[model samples]
Target: MPEINSRQKTAIAAGQKVLNSVNGTPKCLVFTSPAAAAWAQNDTLAAGQKIPAGSRILSNCAVSCGALGASVTFDLGLRHFVTGAEVDLDGIASNVASATAGTYAANNGVLVAGGVDSVTTVDTEPVLTLEAANPTDDIQIRVEIWYLPPG
Candidate 1:
């Protein structure tokens, strides 16, 4: 699975810390398809990381991508960070498609201790799966997750 990701910019880090008050930080996963037929490369991004046990999701998960073409949909999920087990297939969102270029998000309010399952017994990693048609232009996808540590 692809573990390469970026941390949210510092501009929001302080605000996020204040909101969670538990050392919450943001995780941004990105995938870029430089040309047609490259989207299939997403298979390599399956089972990416989410969070550690005892962590909490402090904000709604956000996904942004352009409308490469029609019938492009996505599945954002979370799996056990340590065990690499499937946790929530749609932990972020499901059937996310946009007819026009725009952003899509899932209103998954604050996740209790231990992340989405609230078990606090497992870790997590954000997984991104997409269904798309070949587009002549390049495209990129980004996943944003706000979560606190396993305190």
Candidate 2:
């Protein structure tokens, strides 16, 4: 599925526009970051927008921002792109803000890696992180990404 690019691989880079494998359907990751938290710290990995190990994190992605006041702003990033430490701080989304009450879109310039944007090599959980300076109380959001599970 990666025939058009120069850095193509043999494992196949699945996508909606490109060839979609049977297990390469779009997977939605929804997470909510409450107030006073710069990032998403879920009690369990299943609670947030956590991507499974050996998954292909294709391009088609989105994030919905909840009420966080007009002056509120945040950055949507990734955590544990590598195991143990938090990497790719602003890899998922960056320089995004929120409204008092409505849905907003997130900006993801370089997710995982710029070339293909797939989390194929890593075997750790990749969770979406909503970072803010003073994250207004009761802020919420949902991040959606289309990915292919490890085959």
- Indicate which candidate wins on lDDT: 1
TM-scores, in order shown?
0.59, 0.58
The true-versus-predicted C-alpha distance at residue 97 of model 2, in Å, is: 1.9
Model 2 over residues 49-115: C-alpha lDDT tens digits? 3565666665556666556554455454555544545545455555556545665454454763455
Q: What root-mean-square deviation over C-alphas does model 1 reach?
A: 11.4
Positional deviation of 113 in candidate 2, in angstroms?
9.3
Superposed Cα deviation of residue 66, candidate 2 (Å):
2.6
Error of 2 at 121 (Å): 2.4
Count residue pairs with overlapping backbones in model 1: 7
The numbered model that scores best in TM-score is 1
Give residue 102's lDDT in candidate 1 (0 to 100): 71
Global CA lDDT computed for model 2: 0.50
Q: Report the number of clashing residue pairs per model.
A: 7, 0
